[model samples]
Target: MISIPKDDPAAPDAFPAAPGAPSALETPASPSEVPKETSASLQMPEGLEFYAPNYICLTVFAVIFFPPLGLAAVYFSSKTTEANQNQDWEQAYINSGWTGWLDVFAILIGLAIIYVYTLYM
Candidate 1:
């Protein structure tokens, strides 16, 4: 007679069974009966949607120079307004304005550095 130990690696059934077992593979809940996932829902705040144009412009400016950072700034700033509509428009405007200026400054600085390095080389 052959005996298989519970911890034996060769035994297919050696591992403990999952809780739901075979039922775990059954069909998922129907669309209507399923609890609606609220994760994807957009919950915008009160007044910020109006300044979408500013956000777009900032995003464009960012893309012209540092593509990744600009894209990230555009993404975060856009979401910032969406997450809180009641936020002050003046503040948003100032923040976007500075972000645009910084991107421009970085581009200029990079160009200057490259020009100087080429001259020295």
Candidate 2:
């Protein structure tokens, strides 16, 4: 992409640089283009190699609403979070998959328990 300074005379609009503000096109960020707090490098946990956790609140709710549906999701979230904190993105991604299967397993087990309880009662 052809990047042109916003204040460049050749720019279609040719606007002047804002007094203390850096025009993105005109001045490349000297050191930190993006702020450290929001940067991806800072967010990742240690030991993380590839994956990242997402939609954790939804994952937690899935567990709460269907507790019988595997608390694997709970474990997954914790592990994922830990991995992220430790900067192990890839491992966190892998752990996320386990949560879904565990939930399904929990559901099946829960059903069996209910059936046996009903039969005995």
Candidate 3:
């Protein structure tokens, strides 16, 4: 638990930096002078690895099952590939997850159709 002295109420400068340490107010005045990393410039750090999933399973499902959902899955899978190539790990992961869901849905729908057709016929 944090206990504040009665004499020192919470204020902007209530907490002081340790001696010789730079304060937030001491930051550079110009944004250009400050070094920053942007998303576009991001790269997969060395020693860490990410493997993009191939579209083989999704493609097979698309070929044998629902074409529409399969197509959308393939589309997102393509986007995942693009992101992987660009080293955009976040986007690649998102697109890959989306593709995975679409593939799952397509498989479920296909199985349902097969079951229904066999039962009705």
Q: What is the per-residue lDDT of model 3 for residues 53-117, given as tens digits with 9 covering 90 to 100?
A: 74657666864788788888888888988887677778888988888888888888988999999
Task: Pick the TM-score winner.
Answer: 3
Please tell me which predicted candidate would have the highest lDDT against the true structure: 3
Name the runs in model 3 displaced over 4 angstroms. Answer: 1-48
lDDT of all predictions: 0.56, 0.63, 0.76
lDDT of 2 by residue, 12-31 (tens): 76557657656677665566
Worst 10 residues of 3 by lDDT: 39-48
| TM-score list, all predictions | 0.37, 0.41, 0.58
lDDT of 2 at 31: 63
Q: Write the per-residue lDDT of candidate 1 for residues 8-119, one digit (tens) a residue.
A: 7788864465654334456556655544434234335444354533455645655675565666666556654643343555666665665565556545655666788899
What is the descending lDDT order? 3, 2, 1
Alpha-carbon RMSD to native, per candidate: 16.7, 9.2, 11.1
